[model samples]
Structures are given as C-alpha cells and as structure tokens.
Target: MAIKHILKLLLQQKGISLLIILQVAITVMIVSNTAFISYATLQNWLIPSKLEENQILNVTTRVFDNNIDIASLIEQDVQAIEAVPGVIAASYASHELVLDSQGPGWTMFKDTQPETDYRVFGYFGLDEKGIDVLGLKVIAGRRFYPSEYIKGSFQSNNAGVIMISEELSEALFGNGSALGQTVYISRQRIPHRVVGVYQGKMLGESATYSQQQYHSGIVPEVLWGNRQKLNYLVRVAEGVPERVLQQVETALYHTPGRMVQRVEYAARAKKRLWDGRSTFAFTMSGISLIACIVTAMGIIALVSFSVSLRKKDHGVLRALGASRSMVMTTLIKENTILVFIGLVLGFPLAILLYYFLMNNVHVQSVVELPLLVAVALFTWLISTLAVYLPAREAAKVSPAQVTKSS
Candidate 1:
C-alpha cells in the first residue's frame, strides 16, 4: 500500500522523476571513464623495467637542416656527460620510452636469403648499454660488446649477439626456446645473431602483445640511415634533485655537437597519455556537472509547482491534525525514494560503461578494481550533493499559508 502510494505521488510529478533519473544516469557514465583512466596509469607504473633511477638521463640531439657526423658528436657528448660528478654511465639509443613506437615487420624466415628490407623494422641502432643503462637484465647469453661495431667483427660477433624481450621472443618462437632462433629483420642483409634474451622493459616505449607491432630488431653494421639516429635515455640516481639532471645537459653543451635537448617525462610521456586522459575526464565532468545542475533545477521547479497546486490538500491535512513535520516527511520521502532507485539502477549502469571502455579500448591494458571503487564512490558523493538541495526545498513548505488558504 505504501509502495502504491509512493508510485501515485511520483506519477503526479513526472518532470521531477525524469530529472532525477537523468542526473543519476549521466553521473554514472562520467564516473566510469574516470575509473578506467586511473587503472591504466597505475598499470604502466608497475612494469618492472629497471630504470637507472640513480645515474642516468635521456638526451636527443637533432641534425636540423644539415647532415653531419652525429654518431661522433653523440660519442663526444656522452663522454663529456659521463665526466659530471654524480654520473656513472652514459649511452644512447634510437628509442627512448614509448614515444616513437616502431611498427611491426615479419618474414617467413627459412626461405629468405638476404634479409634486407625496403623499410626499417622495430627499434634499431641503439648505443652500447642502451638496454643496460635502462637496466634490462639479460636472461640468456651475452649483451652486445663494443668491438662488434667493426665491419668484419659484425658477421663474426653476430654469431652470438642478439637479445630480446622474453614476451616478444615467446610471441615469435612460440613455446619452444628462443635462445638460438635466427629471427631475421629485413633491414641490412647482414644476419646479426640473437646472442641473448633479456627481461625487464627496453629503455623506451613498451610493445604490447600485438602481432601487428614489430619487436626491436638489430641495426646491422651496414645500414643507410644509422648515421643520423638521435634516440637517447638517462636514469637518475635515487634522491637526485631535478637540477642534478641539468648537469647532464650542461655536460653535453660543452661537447662539440648538434643541439641536444633534455626530454622531460611530464611534458612527453605523461602528457601523451595521462594528461590527455585527465583532460578527457575534466571535460566530461564539466558536462556532467551542467547536466546534473540542470536536472536538479528541473526537479525543484516541478516539486514547487506540485506543492502550490496541492495547497488545499495540505490545508485539509493540517486541519486534520497532521503536523508540519509529517507533511514535510511525506513530500521529501517521495523524492528520496526516487533518488535511491535511480542510484540502484545507476550502479550497474556505471559498471557496464567501465567494462565497455576497459574491454573495448584499454581491455588489452588491464583493468584495476581499486580505481573503479574510488571513482564510483566519488560519483555517488557528487550525486548526493546534486540531489540534496532539491530535497531540502521540498522539505521547507510554508504550512501556515497552505493551511490558512482555501
């Protein structure tokens, strides 16, 4: 009977009921996207790529309109940077973090003769210790040695000189061991050997399990564009202040080279992904806020009209000895019940939106539970705030005017 009474009251105020439903639905959707973003960021941080947090920094020296001996300039710059007081190691690579990801390439392997391609495959032309300074641990065989840079030594040294991410290796060679598999990148015809397999992330950009994306392939001793590569990375020593990294930039300035620029993680990687995600959240939250406010106002307008139209009914109830508190309770309880129902429906709706984004977009990235909970809680809090004012207005009826009026 109470349920029927509530439904009849709600039906009489269709606009207010619809406003409550819209507010709940829109808030739930916005919160779900926020949850997915939080999960992706936390997942990226957890990767065990041993970053040389104590004694490294990344630098990129570009050869603008002119062509020059960038390799020698890089060597000199690295030498100078290493001379800084706190610096321990220095190396350069053609890739740093996930900024410029190399696309995928593949060949049938056994049937191909000289594996030279018309294009580049994966990350090529890393300096000595590019992997190590990034703190990659070789799970098998040996790391690349400096002597292998020579032409004759290239073929001889390549017989035992390649390492790869274990995940990439497994993808390429399947369940069998990848230690000796002669995977060929169609770069230079020289078949560089895969001497070692390494675990932990490569210095820059992580390649996910995409059959379409290429693994990091070796840049053989003979390649055309190897001369102009500008990829670099640095690991800061633990507790090193921001200005400490300035030493590396200053050190490079002393060396005769093209202009090298320090890559800021915040401006680069975090902006590329996290910042955009945050912006997306901010823009949506603003829109949701507007929608919520408009809906709450609509509810208030409709409830006010309902109270005015029912003045005589309120007067009779007051005449029958109903207290103002009892009349206010009946009115406020009607909207509160609707709000509760909306949230009940919205909880599952929010979960569904979160699932759609996580599975459809970042599904490959991974979904986190804690982030979802926090976001949902935040959404609920905001919804409560939106509904509170409208509920309060309904509670503040002027009983004297209603009871005394016809």
Candidate 2:
C-alpha cells in the first residue's frame, strides 16, 4: 500500500524526479570511472625502477671537436669521477636509465621458418664495469670477462658476447639455461653468445604496453669517437652530499675536447618521465570529488523540495494514523526507488564510457561488477541519509495543521 502511494507521488512530480535521477546518473558514471583510472595509474607509477636511482647520476657531455682521442678522454673522465670523495663507481654508457629512451634493438628469430616466432630487444652497450655500475645482479653464467671488454664504439667493437635479461632468457631458451646459448642479433648471420643473465633490469618505457620493455641485452663494448654526446653513468657512495654532482660537473668541464651538457640525477630523470601520469591521477581525483559533492547536494535539494510541497499530504496521513516512523520510512523508500532507477541507467552509461575510453585512449579501463554494486549501494545509503531530515520535518507536521488550513 505504501509503495503504491509513493509511486503515485513520484509520477506526479516527473520533472524534479527526472532532474535528480539525471544528477545521480552523471555522478555514478564519472565518479566510478575516474576512481578506477586514478587508482590504476597510481599503481603503475609505484612499480620499482629496479635501479639505484637516488645514488646514480648521469653526466652527459658533448665533444666540440670529434678529432680528439675519444677513448682516452672517456677513460680519463671515468678515473676523475671515481676519484671524487663520495663516488662509488662510474662507467661510459651509450644511454643512462633504460626507461628514459628506447635504446638500440634487433629483431631475433629462433629458426629460419617462414612463420618463425621472433622478438625485438633493446641492447645496452656497456663495458665490463657497466653491470656493477647499474647494480645489476648476474644470476647465471658470469659477467663479461675483462678480455671480452673492447675499447671501441659499439659498431666497431663487433663483440660477439652479450648479457641478457632473465625475461629474454626464458623467451629464447625456455626452462633450460640460457648461458652458453648463441642468439643472432637481427638478420645478421653472426651470432652473439649469451655470456650472462641478469635480474631486475628493464628497457625502454616500463609504463608502456610494449612487449620489449623488459627485453634487454647488454653488449660488452664502449662508445667512443667524434660522437656528439658522451654519457657517463656514475654511482655515488652512501651519505654523499648533493655537492657531489657539482663537483663531478666541475671535473668534466676541465676535461679536454668536451663540454658538460648536463649532470642529471637518476631520480630526477624518473620524475620527469612519470610526471604525466601523476598529473592525470590528480586531475581525475578532482573531477571525482566534485561529481560526488554535486550529486549529494542534488539529492538533498530534491528531497527537501518534495517534502515541502507534500506537507498537506503528510498531514493528512498523520491524521489518518500513519506514525512518524512510518512517514519517514515511506519518504526514504521513495528516494531509494529514484536512486535505483538512476543506477539502472547509470550502469549502462558507465560501461559505454569505459569502452569509449578503452577504444579511444587505449587505457585498461576494466569495469569490475563488484565495484559497480558497491557504488550503487553507497549511493543508495547516502541518498537515504540526505532525505532523513526532510522526512523528519514532514513527520513532525501536526494533523491540526491540515485541519486549520482546510
């Protein structure tokens, strides 16, 4: 009987009810999706770089005159940077952090079959000391023998020895050991033997969806010559002062045939790379908060207005025998029905929006059914609470009031 009466009341006030339902629907769609996106981004952001980020510095230099003896200069610079009080170790690298930029890659295949499976991998050209410089753990085989280390640029070294990441190891050789296995670099017939396998090293952009991000190989070679830039990977000792970077920079400026381009901290480089995702998280958080607030306020306003207009009806019911608790329950039930209607519409809209985002932006906007149910229940509870005061006021109206008005 109460439900029928509430249904009639809702049918009479179509405009206000529709407006409130629309507000709830919009809130549900935006708040739920935004929350999921923000959380996903934050989770991705927290993934460890697996490097000594705080203790490492990348000091890049440009050679003004390519004619200078590149190998000698880099060797001297390494010695100088290592001599610093807080310096742990330093080495010359073609690149710094793996996440900073996509490095050199080669498409490799296990067989000569026409439809053979192949994988692309980014190679890091580093000297024997390079593994220690990046703090990479060689879990299998052995590090590059000092004999394997060559003194020329990557192209000229043509070194046939390389270190592979564990992921690449599993991909190429499966469960069996990858050590002593020879894999070809690209289409070239020459084979480079896998000398070592390291853990916790990543290549390219970790946040990207590329399969080759963690597929890394380290070539035991140094880059030297009329190169435009020289990359020095340096690791500082524990409790090193910030002044160590400036000191390192000053030392490089004194080196002949080179100009200091920039002394970059690994942590700073990572921050610059990840700033975009951080900004997106913050933006979505703000949007979700505003949507929730607007929806809550809309619920309050609509319920209050309905109660005000139905004062006479509430009075008539109270006079006939409806208790205060009964009047409040009826009003709450009415608001819950409206909320349910909005949720029914909002769920489909949310799914469509998620699909739109996934297709357009390529984000992993997977909608969990349990999350949807929780959001619905939460909104229903809050809407009922928002209507509580208005319901109480309606219940407080005396039967004599309607009698007096009539």
Candidate 3:
C-alpha cells in the first residue's frame, strides 16, 4: 500500500524523479569504470619479475673506441666484476635490463606454419651465465650449455639454442613437451631448437605489453656491435647489493676504451618502470571517490527537498495511526525503488562505457561480475543512508502540527 502511494507521488513529480534517476545512472557508469581501471593498473604494477631484484644490479657501459676488441673487453669486465667482494655472478646481454621500459624486441615464432600459424614474442640475447644472473628457475629443461654461448651483434640470428619462459611454452606447444622441438624465428624463418623452459614473470620491454609480459625468450649469445652500448646484469650476495654497486664502476674502469654509463639496483629500476602507472591508478581511484561523494550529496539534497514538500501527508498519516518508524521506513523504501530503477538503467550504460574503453583505451582487465554486483550493493547502501536524516525529520511531524497548518 505504501509502495502504491509512493508510485502515485512519484508520477505527480515525474521531472524530479527522472532527474535523480539520471544523476544516479551517470554516477554509477563513471564510478564503476574508473574503479575497474584503477584496479587493473594496480594489479599490473604488482606483477613479480621472478628475479632476485633486491640483490641484482644493471650496469650499462658505452664503447667509444673502435679499435678495441669489444668482446674481449666484455669478458675482462665480467671477470673483474665477478672478482669484486660480494659479487656472485654477472652476464652481458644485447638489451637493457628487464623492467627498464625501453620497449621490447618483438619477433614471430611458429611450431608449424601454413605460413600463418605464428605467435609473436619479445626476445633478448644472454650469455650462459644470464640464467643465473636473472635468477630464473629452469622447470622443464636444462639451461644453456657453455659451448652454446656466442658473441654476436644485436641483429645476429646465429643462435642455435633458445630458452623460453613457461608462459611461452604453454602458448606455443600446449600440453606437449617443448623440449627438443624446432621452432622457427622471425621473417627469415630461421629454425632454432628449444633447449629449455624456465619460470619467470618478467615484463616484456615495457609494462604496456600486458599480455606479453611473460612471453620472453633468451638466446645463448652476447651482443657487441659498432657504437652499441653493453648492458651487464649482476647478481650479488644477499645484504650487499648497495656495497657491490659502489664497486662495479671502479671495476669496470679497469678496462679502457669504455665508460661506465650507469649502475643501479634492479629493484630501483623496476620501481621507476611502474611508478607512472601506479600514480595514474591512484589518481583514478581519487576521482572515483569524489564521484561517490558527490552522488551521495545529490541523493541527500533531493530526498530532503521531497520530505519538506510531503510534511503534510506525513502529519496526516501520524494523526491517523502510522508510527514514526513506519513513516521513516516508507520514505526509505520509496528512495530505494528509485535507486533500483536507476541501477537497472545504469548497468547497460556501464557495460557500454566499458566496451568503449576496451576499444579506444588500453584497459587490461575484463569485466568482473563480482565487482559489478558490489558496485550495485554499494549504491543501494549510499542511497539508504542519504534518505535516513530527511525521513527522520519528516517522521517527527505530529497531528497538532498538521492541524495548525490546515
């Protein structure tokens, strides 16, 4: 009966009811999508590289003299770095350190091709000690053999043995064994045997490649070319990375014809990589919070205005028989109905907005059902609270007040 009366009242003020409903629908659409983006960005920021990041350092060096033997200089630098106290191991690679945000070197590989059955992956060349320096765990196969190590330029494709991440293993070969299988790389279709599979969650050159973060492959090769700088990944003893960082530059200076460009802890570099995205996620969360507050304020003001207009009806109800609690409950139920209708309309709008973001923006997560349900319940809770104070004030209206007004 109260619902029927409330529906009649809402019909009499169609413009106000529709306005509140539209406000709620817009709020729900904006808040939910922004909240989802924030959640996904934070999730990406927390992904582990599966490396001994705290105890590892990346040392970048530039070779300026053309006459020096770059490969021999690299070997000498490696020896000197390893001899430093607290240093465990070090290896040179073609690319910058993992999580440096320099972007990835992408290439295509295939198990068997009708010329189209191929998948793309980011790759970098590493020496035999690269696995140990990066702290990768070999789960299904062996690490690169010492004899497989080679010295080559960045574009050199002469590696005969390749080690892939477990994610790539599942992507290319499914449940079957990837060991000893011949997969072709790049457009030249050069075939290399998969010698090993290791486990790591290292990001592909940048964090933007969300799907390809773990789709990495390492070859048993070290890079040296004209005007190309060298990147050395060093693993140190626990509790001594900072001490070892101080010594790496001096050790590298022992070898002439090159300059130590930079030496930094891998953990610090990884933080720098994700810092921008983390800030963006936090900013979005703040915006969503403000939107929720504004929506709640709107609901409160609308309900208060409606209660002021309905004081006479509330007074007559109390004069007849209705208790204070009954009046409050009826008012709350009416607002709840309005909120429910708004949610019904807002759900589709939220989905459309999500689709627009996925198509036009770089949203990384899919729509989650539980998150949507939670948003709905939260909206309902906010509306209930917003209605409470106004309803309480209206319920205080007595029979004497109605008589005096009349």
Candidate 4:
C-alpha cells in the first residue's frame, strides 16, 4: 500500500493508534535506559580490582585507650604481624583498599603550569613494602630507597616523593614514560616526582564512572600517629591455611595498647562491593523484562481489537478478490505505521530522559545514537510479533460467514 493510503486508514482509528503509540513510546524509553544502566553496573562488578585480591589480607586496628601511644602500638602490631610464619610481606596503609576509595584524592597536573583540566587520582601513604605486600609489579623506574623513606610518625614538611600506577602514567603522559617526571597535587601545587610505575593498582571504586579509579599514587610514609589509624596489608605465602589469619590477628592483639578491630581477606571485601552492584543490575534487568512483556501484551490487545472490528471489511475485500496474503499484509502494514509513529515520538523522549539523568541526577550514562536505534528496532520487532497472530486471524475471515450473519 502507498504511504498516504496507510496514513488515511490509520487516521480512521486515530484514538486507538494514538494510545498504542504512547504505550510503545513509554516502553522503549524505559527499556533502553534500563538496559544501559544494567550493562554499566555489570561491567563494574566484573572488572578486577587490579590488586592482589586473593592473596592479600586487611587488618584494621585502633587505639581503644586514650593514653596509649598509638604510634608505638602500631609499630608493635606490625612487628607481630610480620612475625607470623605464613606472611611473605606486610605494610601499613592509611587506606584499607584502594578500590574502596577510602583514602585521600588529589587533582594532579602533568606540569607545574596551572590548568583547569587536571586529572584526579587517589593519593595514599604506604610504607616501602606497600607495593610488594599488595603484589603490585613495578614495571618501570625504581622503588623508593631506604633514605627516601619518610621516617617517623609525622611526615616532614618536605615535598614527598611518590610512585604511580601505569594507568595514571598513561592518562597523564600517554605511552611516554612518567618516571622522574613531576606532577603537582592539590591547590598548593606540591611537586612530587614519580619514582616508579606499577601495574594492578586501582585507586578508587570500580563502579565510579570515571577513569580516575586506575590513577593511583603512592607515597613512602610510615603514617603512624595517635590520631591516625593505619590498616595493615599482609601478603600470605602460597599454601597457607585459613588459620593463618587467626594467628596473625592474635599476634597483632598480643600488644597491650591496641585492639584488632577486624581481620579478613581482601576477596571478601571485594565480593561485598560487587554484590551491591550485582543486585542493582538484577533489579534493572527484572524491570526491563517486565516492561517489554507488558508492552507486547498491550500491542497484542490493540491489534486483536482492531482486527475484530474490521472483520466484515476483510470479508468484503476477500469477496472482491483481495487474497489472504493481501489481507494479512494490510493489517501488518497498519500496525507498522503505528510503530513508526511511536519511534518518532519515543526517540526524543529517551533523549530527554537521558539529558535529565545526566544533568540533574549526575548519572553516568553514554548517549549513543546507535544504542537508541537498536532499542527502537527491538521495540518494533516485539510489536510485529505481537501483531502477527491477530493479522493472521483477520486474513482467515470468510466472506460467506460474514454475508450469512448479515
């Protein structure tokens, strides 16, 4: 049929077609955005933390008593934990895990020159063994020498030396080497020289929709004070039994002034984080499935009702030499026109929702024309399937049966 004829036929059922079009528009908008949200959530859950997640353990302790010198207590605890037989290396960290985003962050610039487009990265204070304990591989430059260690409980006023991850290096300097280069952190523009580049260091939560998570910078500082509670990262030797954690905990708690608040594997914490994201993804998937099903059912109902009302017309056309195939095609074409109209209305609605989410809610979403097109195609596919049975039933209508009833 020509486009104008199809439009005239659709105009005759303007009320029903408009209602179906609105239903389709709403369904497409919800489904496409939900699909994108689910995908982003799942990706974050699946990405590795870029740390020795399995072999590492976290031990957090705090000073329970006020008068106790926390610096001395932390030193004693570190010594005790390191003394455990299965421990390959141990180090203190001001942050529990870089993936948890529990530490400080700084906006860094490649050069000392001021610019507005600076990148943000996690800044952490770690001991010399922090890299080794976390199983981070120094791919370039060199680790901090003993003399470069920021000794004592309090960091000196000197500009600190630091190491960065390969991700941060690439972000700041691309493929070029970042070693021995200077970057300024914070508004003070404190200059820190990158001494080493390591792999598998994540600086923030994986779910964050920013590239800054991989840009981790480490400083060689003891970071122990009465006011500061440091977390211990212990690398257990291979073939170590589960009891090693208990032994390590006991060793740390053997000291008088401090208490071991928690001792657990890093994998547990990682699982906990991913669980939340997974739950969100599953919820979105459920909602998307429900929307598609409801939309399909609505389409089927509208097409079926239209077919019933046009039964006598199909009978008359068939009697006048319209073939069964032609009758089927007419019904299908009418519904297709409705779907096309819905797509025209739905695209803007989806874009408007995306804009509202991106601007007002600060959601992490990528607006892609192809993604929207794919969603429209899917909605049309479902609508076609729903209309097929109704269209087929209309084609089977007999002129004799309609004439006898009349």
Per-residue lDDT tens digits of candidate 3, residues 1-406?
Answer: 3678889988877876887788778878877787677677666568776767788888988887888877678788899899999999998877667653223435547754655566556676778787788888889888877777877655455767788888888888899999998887776677889988988557455323455678777887775664558888898998884767778899988666778988888777777766776676677678777877888888788878888888899999999999999999888888888988999999899889998977787555456787788888988888788788988999999999999999
Query: Candidate 4 local accuracy as lDDT?
Result: 0.76
lDDT of 3 at 85: 96
Q: Give the lDDT ranking, best first.
A: 3, 2, 4, 1
> What TM-score number comes out for model 2?
0.74
* Comparison by lDDT, 1 against 2, better one: 2
Error of 4 at 231 (Å): 1.5
Clashes of each: 17, 0, 0, 0
Evaluate model 3: give its lDDT: 0.78
Output the worst ten-in-a-row residue range by lDDT, candidate 1: 203-212
> Tens-digit lDDT track for model 2 on 289-311?
78877777887888889888989
Error of 3 at 75 (Å): 4.5
Q: Candidate 3, 40: how far from true, in Å? A: 3.0
Give the C-alpha miss distance for residue 254 in model 4, angstroms: 5.9
lDDT of 4 at 394: 93
Task: Give the range of the ten consecutive residues with the poorest summed lDDT in model 4.
Answer: 203-212
Query: Tens-digit lDDT track for model 4 on 124-172?
Result: 7777788788777889999888887775656566436888888788988
Q: Residue 290 of candidate 1: its Cα lDDT? A: 71
How does each model score on lDDT? 0.54, 0.77, 0.78, 0.76
Candidates' TM-scores?
A: 0.66, 0.74, 0.82, 0.84
